[model samples]
Target: MDDHTALIRATLDHIHQGVCIFNKENRLVGWNQQVANMLSLKLTQFRVGADFDFLFRRLQDELRIQSGTSPASVLAWVEDRGPRPPLRFEVRQRQGRVFDIFAQEMPDRGFVISFTDVTAERRAAAALRAANDLLEARVEARTAEIAVALADAERANASKSRFVAAASHDLLQPLSAAKLYCASLADDTLAPAQTEILSKALNALNSVEDIIGALMDISQLETGNAPVRVGAVDLGRVLRQLGDELHPAARAKGLDLRIRPSHALVQTDASYLRRILQNLIGNAIRYTRTGRVLVGTRTDGDALRIEVWDTGPGIPLAEHENIYKEFHRIDPAANTGNGLGLGLAIVERACALLDHPHGMHTRLGRGTCFHLTVPRAGLPPRDAALPAPEPGTDLAGLIVLLVEADSQTRRALSGLMERWGVEVLDVASGTEAAALLAEIDLVPDAMLIDAPVDDGHAGLALIARLRAQFGQVPCRMLTADCTPGLGADCVLMDVSLLLEPVDPAALAFFLASARVSG
Candidate 1:
């Protein structure tokens, strides 16, 4: 060989990558030292002029190379490899090392093969996979912990709701009794000055009750305790009752409580609708000093628009958005008679819960109008032949069974019943009533049962016992606030319910109606 050829051979010996060349006659012509090291070939058998097949068989057997087949099969594959394009392949040795091999045909018709070690790349990929597995495990554990914390928070909120609900009744019982006593006292013969003083006291008592009741409702609604029940609601009946209840107060203020007659029924939660209208109308009455507060309705496409128009100090455009926020008022310093400013907040929440659209339109000092759009009920129109309840029913000489737990409530109720000339048997519990029933010769014509009595079941138990013995006597269940479940129980018992602080006149009317129905 020439000197240049010898120098090239020396350079190939010092190269890092394994390289081998075969002549056109398919004999091994040259190879670097790296080829022998990489394949673990015996240098004695890897001589120049060795047949390419011999060299290939020696490398394959020594390195335990895997070609997805046996050594004989690989030899056959190598024999069939004629003139072809360049090719690349990967292989793993028995010693757990990896390699990338490249083979190409030279321009002179000789073949060259080269190999590179890739074992480190494979090890790095393995470490990355282990890290990914650890990360996934930690994420799953954190998700489980968050779910447990969420459940704990929900349970705590429910417990708080129950405590508030029970406390509302206890708080209102005394207020209800005092209101009843005031009403009974107003009926007595007294001087004009004494009568006027008693009237102011009654007004003060009513304002206190209104504040307490509004707070309880707002608390229940905000805490997600009040369940939303959507159904067809008789807006006409609700408006009429609301107007009747608040008419006395409006007249006392010398403002007109005008409720236009409407036969429109709408799709909404009936109780929630009542509350919304109650707040709006109550605000109208409380704010308006001289003019009128009109509760009216009109049809707007497939919706019924119920509007409360009041001749009161109108809301400013800037304050309109802020009005629905909790404890917000247009005139903060003005004495608007015991308003905590939660009325419109309750209205806004009720609208959102029902998915109903609501807005207000007002002009400075002309009047303010608040309206809500309720979806028109799809049911057929109400039958015109349906009869209304007979009013002004007399209660003289009617025997009434009254079950009340509070001492003041019992005395106030007894006094009201006596004033109406109705015979009342007032007891603190169902057990006492049963014992009294055994002793009394006269049977009760109707029952007025106080709900959520001792153990939360006494009122219901008494009703069932009375029904079993008396056979469907007309009964009225009285409560501070009638919860949804208790309302369902009242329906099942086929009885009427009166929420406190109950109006004495309303109670007397209910008792008289019960006597007539019995």
Candidate 2:
């Protein structure tokens, strides 16, 4: 090597910045001895061709974006971007501390860039940045807290949102149970006046559920937890199912429901897709009293464009974008048993999860169209179709033990059982039911235990309790909570569950089905 080359290499080696020399072809030509030291490179075994991906990633994470960007690209632009600052980039290999990265073009043949371990300098800068970030974060958090505190005065409203979001699960648990109990009451056959009182109770329960669920949806979207499960789906089938489910509701509300299917397959989660359509159509039915809800689909290159159109009180053009925001309800006091204004927010979040593009087109008082384009779902899974539950036999001349807490509920439920022509023995508490089980020689054909459960979640301990007592006795939970993650628990315990305040018809059907399966 020439004298200048040797000097450059030696001088660059003593510098404190991570440096490398690259040729015009953007290949690493040479690097100073410091690069090896900082990267934990052993002098005896040095590699000159390795990429700078790690170096840049460390920089990016450290917020040394400018410093990090040059690892792959040449630093020639540093000339115009101002004097290259000694940037604090993290050394991923050692991960000891951040380091300052300094670089300059070579004066001679190729280039000679060296690195000096400036971990201390980096740490110092990072410490400062972290302190600032922490301070900023605290400020943000405090600001939110204040917003919640003064929510009535319009100040704490924002912070109240954050606080509510954090404590939602705890707040919603009891409310969910109460709702289930209310539904159970509604499911009971009573005089018309009594039923009217129960209907009011059901409506109140629904409102609480809507608010809690909406808040949870907002939190999930904001926190990026609502991940999309990409899979192959039949879009036509999804539309049809949505139509079947919502058409009646729409018609009941004097709204038209139309599903225009396109013969396109999607590689996305069918559940998420269905949720999207349901939210859209449900909103249409809620807002448009005498209009139409139309769902249409098309193909655009590699994307599947799904559209939800509604002839409702069309959104004001200026407010279209804002409607996707959290709690952006146009009719705040409609009280139509519709959910918290979380539908659009959830749709927005779902779109993000799917990496889909969503847009809104509205003609005030005319109609509104929401369009989202998603990449097609992949090929169908081999295990797409899970077999339905085996139909069980009729419980002819059989006795059933309705083991549950809540005295009034037990009586109402007993009446339901009596109506089914099955002998029913209702108890005030689960303990009473247990006592009966201990005394009775012939165990009831099946037990419908309104059993209290551990964890205070939606699931029941009844599944395990019954399975332990009488294997395959067909125990199902009559719970009100509608959360996921129950199927696994049911499978593990070999139990079946039906949501609470079970419809007598559906319940009877389930009982006969359980008998057949047994």
Candidate 3:
């Protein structure tokens, strides 16, 4: 019997689960080393005759059950759930360990209990939950930050658009004044050298004007302000007009400039096509030192290829892509023009807006040719309506009432009109204009008014009042704003609107047209 008892103890000690047994008298009859270890008990303390309460008290202490709790209370709670059947539940200890506890009823009206550690599984699950919660918190924070950044970027873009518009309008006013004064200067007699000097100065001023105008165009394109108006465009007429306008510049440089007419009509925005060709041709004449600059067109399948050939130092293969970027210039010394290097950039944007495919072919030190494909109109070309010819010197006694708020613009325009033999009544305000009209005996032939005549104040009401007083006086409105609403307002007011910088010759032609209509 002693040897059998020794074998049973050895087998129980080797078992994975902690085991303990109680007799019918409720005294602990048997226990293994695993049971004592699990309950944090010494083998001597867990005597063979000790009561079941001793094991319960040991378990309660290890689990940190409230100090006021006694072994009898735990036993009573377990017993109140009814006679313990073969049941399983969990027990957790204060030392961060857990176990699955099982109870089995014995045939002799006693019970046996077992404990199995399950701490690793529970700890891993708890760690995963914590990590998931942290990830969700980070994602929410990042999304909120991106939303704020996007809103700030939108506001900054809006502010930049407004600033560009305002600055362009203001800058053109002084440029208009300068251009008018230059025209008046053209009528003065001077030495041959002086004449040449004056011509050079005018050219320089035109360059400055072009730079500002290009900047404005870029701003308009970026802000979606430039609306493309597509219609039947006569490539012949457009080519002819460009030839007439740009021939003198090319001739002055002793370069051969030729325009081959094409009667082909194309579907396009005439204005945008004109701008594209102008930039191409201007670059050709600007860069070429000695050779021909040819402008012509040909049919290629269903499209017309309008090409500009230049004898300038051709662009390299590497620079073909970069040349279209703003402020990118290959060689500044290749041309005498003080361009802002935005000509090709504008051409690129206009082509993109028109959906026209354009590209260039060049061979370094030889020559270059740039071309754009335009879809054929497939219809006859319409003759452009031409304005009446302005009198060369017969504008004498043409009474004109001018209202301009910019002093420089007023002075320059008034001087130019007087020089052209037109009687000018110029004023800086609507009130001064009213006083001038009261003093004059004869009614003026036409009224020329500048928009926003008083520093940032629109002249709409003043125009209405003048129209009411003059009774059907022919009025012309000059402004730098090309906004959509302004055009509608001009139409409703029954006034002719001219964009600035105002050309003296164009103004004369406009006045003649007004006279014929009136």
Candidate 4:
């Protein structure tokens, strides 16, 4: 029997599962090392005669069963649920190492049990299930947002397209008519009060032009049609030019236009850079009804820096980003020609296109300043000798024939021209001027006609008549409808061209240049 015992121990140790020998009365006659390990420990070491019932009583199952039972009964309970070929569980072992236990009915009488460390596999399965749940949740969230966002974008795009089409037709047509009428009224002889009223009308027309130009620029920028010419830009020169050009406009509104000297040059498209300053300056002048607008520049390491300051109704912190959204007007009924709300959008896009870094600083009710850092457009060596705009009397005794349909515009223009010392024969319209020419014998050296009426800012017929009869006269066309190649068109029509709402100085200089060119 001792030899049989040694043989049974050897066989059980070699077996992969737990082995135990019990009599017909259900007594633990012997157990192998595998059974002891699988069941936590040698129970006989504690109670000398401890049996399976003691360990079974401590077993806990997912079904919440609590009882001491034979291994065969436990196996029957698991298999009863279904055709379970295998049963798995954890056992309370003496060691802390967790093990998965499996039990099966042996061929003869007793049972064979097996156990292993399945902690890694169980954890991995749990992790996979968790990951799957997280992915499903994310997919659901994204699916919800996709529909609403796309619908909003599509609707917005359609509305914008319709607006652009309508503006192209409706606005430009009436604007053309108003310009012609203003030109004709300019020549009408009237009292100072009547003249002032006419001037107001012309001013209104000029405002219309500003609004139209702003809208057009915004639309073109959105459509990706605005021409971008990349070239060297001088920051100082542009700042100074804006300072001089806007100074009078700011002063007219009881504000100051100031510029701080810039030491660095910027490497960017000069035209694009100029447009940025134009928008910024335009914005500053619009909001700053009381205080001052200042354009300043400084050095930013290897980059050139620029800043625009305005002491007006400043922006709130939360609004800084929203203000850059296209066509996002802050004021529902903005009376001032501030913008169509696309000015800053254009500025932002321009900076991105130029690869410049930009930011803004503002305090509510105080003022705001926007700044940008642009790469230096490696400047060229300046010529040793450069001449400034020389002071000269190029307009003394200059003779000009001015034909305009708008009386107020004529008055304003006449004031500007007279200030330049040009002797202007201001007429109400091209027709009246033609009749006046037929009656009088005096021939002016030059004639400038505001080209458009309800028919066109520039009357093609009137220009043809002027060319046919007064071939020697240097005719100039002026209008508020500023477009690319406009000046070239006038050149082709055999006349000098000038933009309307003309600066007294610019008109004077243009005439001087025209005389020289002719």
Residues 1-518, candidate 2, lDDT per residue (tens digit)?
69988898788777666577654333465666666666665665445664344333433553333345544344444323333333333333335544444444444333334445556666688899999999999999999998776565443444454465446544544554555455456656789999988878766765665566566556545644334456556766566445544555565577767788555667666656666776777777777756688888777888888888888778875676778877677766753665667888888787777677888888877888888887775543242321223324345665776765545556666666665577876765556766777887556666676534333232356445655776667565544332223423442344444434343434565566455545
Superposed model 2: Cα runs more than 4 Å off: 1-197, 226-228, 236-248, 251-264, 378-518
* Cα displacement (Å) at residue 367, model 1: 2.4
Per-residue alpha-carbon lDDT of candidate 3 for residues 1-518, written as tens digits (9 for 90 to 100) = 99999998899889988887777667787778886676666888778777776557656757743235445555763454346657666667877777777777777767777878778887898888898889888888888988899778667766766676677678888888888888888899988988898788777777777787677667666765466776666777677556644665687789998888787888888767877888999999989998999998888999999999998889988899999999888888766888889999989998999999999999888899999999998776555433333344367788899988888988999999898788999998889999989887557888888887222226666778887888878777777664434543554455546556776655776566556645
Rank by TM-score, highest first: 1, 3, 4, 2
Tell me the tens digit of each residue's lDDT in model 4 across 1-518.
99997997788787766655533223356666775655555555433234555545554431132235445767454334333354456543343345566655444444444656554676687799999999889888887788788778667765775566455535654564455455556656889998899878866776765666666556645655444555555556555445544655676678877777564556776646766777888888877768888887776788767889998778876787898898786663643663467778878987776678888998878988988887776754342211122225377677778887766667666766676677888898887888887788566777878766234434656877866786756566765443323432443344444444454444544466445534
Task: Estimate the lDDT of model 3.
Answer: 0.76
Residue 170 of model 2 has an lDDT of 45
Alpha-carbon runs more than 4 Å astray in model 4 = 1-200, 261-264, 332-335, 380-518
TM-score against native, each model = 0.72, 0.46, 0.59, 0.47
Clashes of each: 0, 22, 0, 28
In model 1, what is the error at residue 266, expressed in angstroms?
2.3
Predicted structure with the largest TM-score when compared to the true one: 1
How far residue 483's Cα lies from its native spot in candidate 1, in Å, is: 3.7
What overall lDDT goes with each candidate model? 0.76, 0.59, 0.76, 0.62
Reference-based lDDT, residue 390, model 2: 34
